[model samples]
Target chain A: MDNVSQEDYLTAIYRNLDEAGEIKPNLLASKLEISNAAVTDMLRKLSRDGFVDYQKYKGIKLTGEGELYAKNMLRRHRIWEVFLHQTLGMPWDKVHDEAEKLEHSSSDEIINLLEEFLEYPEVDPHGYPIPDKNGKIKKSKTVVAITELNENDTAKVIRVNDDVKNLLSYVTKIGISLGKEIIVKDKLEYDGSVLMMIDRKEVNISNKIASNIFVEKIK
Target chain B: MDNVSQEDYLTAIYRNLDEAGEIKPNLLASKLEISNAAVTDMLRKLSRDGFVDYQKYKGIKLTGEGELYAKNMLRRHRIWEVFLHQTLGMPWDKVHDEAEKLEHSSSDEIINLLEEFLEYPEVDPHGYPIPDKNGKIKKSKTVVAITELNENDTAKVIRVNDDVKNLLSYVTKIGISLGKEIIVKDKLEYDGSVLMMIDRKEVNISNKIASNIFVEKIK
Candidate 1:
């Protein structure tokens, strides 16, 4: 049950849960980049292990034990992220992938020690909150995707979907990062791309990319 | 060729090779605590992959590629060990197991960065030499096992066989550690255990334990 694939499934389920705390098997399969049959097979195993609640043709939900496991995995991931970026001076774009592999290998003791070593970082480099030891995630400012803002909406980047492939590198190329201020210059309804002013330069981003970059409204 | 078990086999073969740079499969099985059948199965695969030159009932020898791969793994392992013990403040006894998992997960880039971050450590906390990027192990003072020291020979603990299970913890319990000075008091020819004085106190260590604890003779 504690194998790498199972651990990965738990974290993937936890990350993609909607407001209702449920996710479809199809979505889970897509997120994991596995086949539908494969997802179904794993879901059944997860259910049998008491880590997930699954019914045929229905959404998947993590059990209490499952949620705790997922959050702890997240705790390991984000802490490793902090250690790689803040302590090791690795690039933010590079830290997520490095931390992903490391998170599975590290123990709770290592995570706790890293937390103390990093002065108990509140967030990872991408600005995602770090869950505490007891699976408690500190509540931070509410954030919205850049695409949700209106024209001329001034905001500050607070978080990005670190899970998205190449998203961080693409955003970094556009001079975007945690704490960077952006002004929404225009919203193109035709292609759903947003023209935003970052670092005083105009950059147009796709709706998908804009949606992954979360920001807090400034004014 | 890059799987964890394969990597472990390569490193084990590299570490246990005799003066002629070969290891009997029986010894390898014993070292890994796996079945001889299992070791044979893996050895066949290793030979097929050109990582080893294997024959039925003959000592195993790592090919050039296998040695490079094993040394690279050692580089990852020892660098991680230094980071865990020196930078993260993990206990020396705890670092080996932690580094074992980490060695398989880290990338070459991560290992290089960690080396630079630690200012290029010459050795791990347990005193095993770290292999550099080119698989070069920096030559240092020659060391001999404490078992090899004669009566009245003073020595400074330099390296310990970190692969031996619970050896570090057991030695630590006897007040042994890197840089600790030891004076050989006597050796029992019967059991081959040695009585050594450390910190002005005498402690008798078994031959097996003494053999695992390497030191440079100071007298």
Candidate 2:
């Protein structure tokens, strides 16, 4: 595709397919914030271009070519995020937006050099696995939402599902980050808020926020 | 301007206006490698947008807003070049094309961060002055083409006027770069070639190549 919007659609479709095994036009529209008509038009074009297999009522599936394109885009995006956050010392919360802009412009040579320069990082600042040059993403260990953890269970913050700046900033302010050790002190039944101990400091996180944080059991 | 082509046109206009006092449609067309009709169309659009003062036959000039926009794009382009060459260790010959792609995508915040990260560099990798945030550029000392220096005169390489990859790569291979010390040894009248001493080694550069290099006299 000649434009970034087309790339965005391919990436969105790949992500939806990866997560849900299929993509619906209405779902794609909602995800892209575009109208159903626009989605249908794009789907037709993509199908004609052999990037997708689309049927009138059946869900959409990415063709092999589309999957490769999406994976490459993802690799560029995550690598840029790592460069901004790790090498440049930018705050993790602020890197996503910058990476989004940079990914579309990065050439293969640039990405290759960047991958080497960053010492071949496996994951981005948000703990999302980065795809290799060949679009191979190493599967990560199983992780569960913090809200799924039992009271008094200790876990390590493996990833944050939500990369929203405000949420990241809030978590950072409360001294919570990837690899941080947290103990679930209590789960309030009244409001679904979870009381946790981070670095011996007690903090209460709303269930919504808790659900967005993925953690791995320590023991 | 909403797109890169428009921004490119504005920057080209600004550069032409800065180098020469005026710009003609044909000159701009050649500079941008586009047709005269395309240049005329864009100039009209820019004129409508109040970014340029375009007359039917006389010439075109950038308005204050247009100059500012051009300066910003130039600033982003040079800063990215510096980042690619200095921070990423990319060869100078390879940075220009990469910077061209990156400049359009860099946001104000990213540029600002990059400027700070680079410790507020005054010039790009090619020794061209980088515009400040307010579009202010610090002018360098007076310089002249290398061919202008008399025999036995010492000078410091200040800038390379030509940025063509092959030319840059050749110069780089010959150990010619910004701030390099050289002494004029002889001028061959046969082909207008100049003999010079660089790092205690004698080298001969053609007049064409010599003219592309600007140097400041070493007093």
Candidate 3:
């Protein structure tokens, strides 16, 4: 609780729970790049502090208090990312790391003021919805990955998963960003690559990269 | 080294050494609101770590490396204060505490970028010169406390010591801020109060408050 690594662990657990509905110690150790023994020690401590429900053999789950804390951290992180991207003109690829550092030190007052300063942005530059002060996030429906779309279908880019900086830079270089209209011209069966028309220019994207982009179909 | 308390100790030592050319353990203990024993223990550790030249009977002095580290911390703290007051429109009285929290988490890259964003301000909102990245500070000459000026003397406000929030709020309410021109009208000999004219209006300030405001005589 005194260091950023502890916060990272809690957030990682929250993310895993959100994505997969459960957390395994081995998976957490890999995610954090720490050894399994170290992860066990931390999990034991977190369990003792009532931040996690952890059993030696069973998996892990966040308690109510733990979920609230993780959600607040996420809120701070996304708000800062938005500030860096929109206000400071930082590249979307560059905002995540800076926001990660700033989030640990931001107080509730600063976060609220920043939220007001940014005029209550609903999502970050990468299109991830920011959690509200009360830890409630508005779920987005009717959005599917670009890789799921059929050939000749057109869609409007909604969000891009920002887990990789290189992918974001690549996407930005190719003019694939939020609100851009893209048409799937063809899907190569040989390598799973896709040919798309963005801004009236044809571009090729690998299936891996295409899956990271979420879009809403254009009527 | 991992927590803000450690940074606070180093900066406090640097400030004392800069102001008085020496530091006593008891004085440092009082300044930090810790016990003498705790101060001694921390000093011993700092000495062993080569950050301070601590002797059994004599006082302590920062090593060259320690001085640099402390200066960097000061630079970050002052920069954040300037950002909070100037950019965020936070009340000057409320900036110091927020800056204290932010300085620890700010990385070197962020500080440099922020300095650019702020147009490389030489001084913080309180008028204290911010140290450069190399830990070099420009010393201001011809500045003296308002209490030292005689009646009928006019001076331009330079900087106010920002250690006390109530004093900062009171000065702001009285329209005394950086670059304001003030003329001393009268000095109350019995209680050491001074009546001054600011913005074409007269205001009285206590001797203690006057001592904290530095100003340069208007030739």
- Top model number, TM-score: 1
- Model 1 spans > 4 angstroms off: none
Instruction: Give me the displacement of residue A112 in model 2, in angstroms.
Output: 2.2
Give all candidates' CA lDDT scores.
Answer: 0.93, 0.88, 0.88
Q: lDDT per residue, candidate 2, A14-72, as tens digits?
A: 76774656888888888788999999898888889988888988899988998899999
Between candidates 1 and 3, name the one with more favorable TM-score: 1
The residue-by-residue lDDT of candidate 3 on B79-186, one tens digit each, is: 999888888788878888888878888777778888988899999999999999999998875699999999999999999988654888889999998999999999
DockQ, per model, reads: 0.81, 0.60, 0.47
User: Model 1 over residues B34-93: C-alpha lDDT tens digits?
Assistant: 999999999999999999999998899999999999999999999999988987899899
Better of 1 and 3 by lDDT: 1
Q: Pick the candidate with the highest DockQ.
A: 1
Candidate 1 chain A: worst 10 consecutive residues by lDDT?
A: A1-10
Model 1 misses residue A177 by how many Å?
1.3
Query: Which rank order by TM-score, best down to worst?
Result: 1, 2, 3
Model 2 CA deviation exceeding 4 Å by range: A18-20, A150-153, A162-176, A180-211, B18-20, B150-154, B162-166, B173-175, B181-209
Q: Give per-residue CA lDDT, model 3, range A1-219, as digits (tens).
A: 545777888988887773545799988898788999999999998999999999888788999988988998999999989988887778888888788778888788889888988999999999989999999999975799988999999999999987665888889999998999999999999888889999999999999999999999987
Clashing pairs in 3: none
TM-score (chain A only) of candidate 2: 0.90
Between which residue pairs do clashes occur in model 2?
none
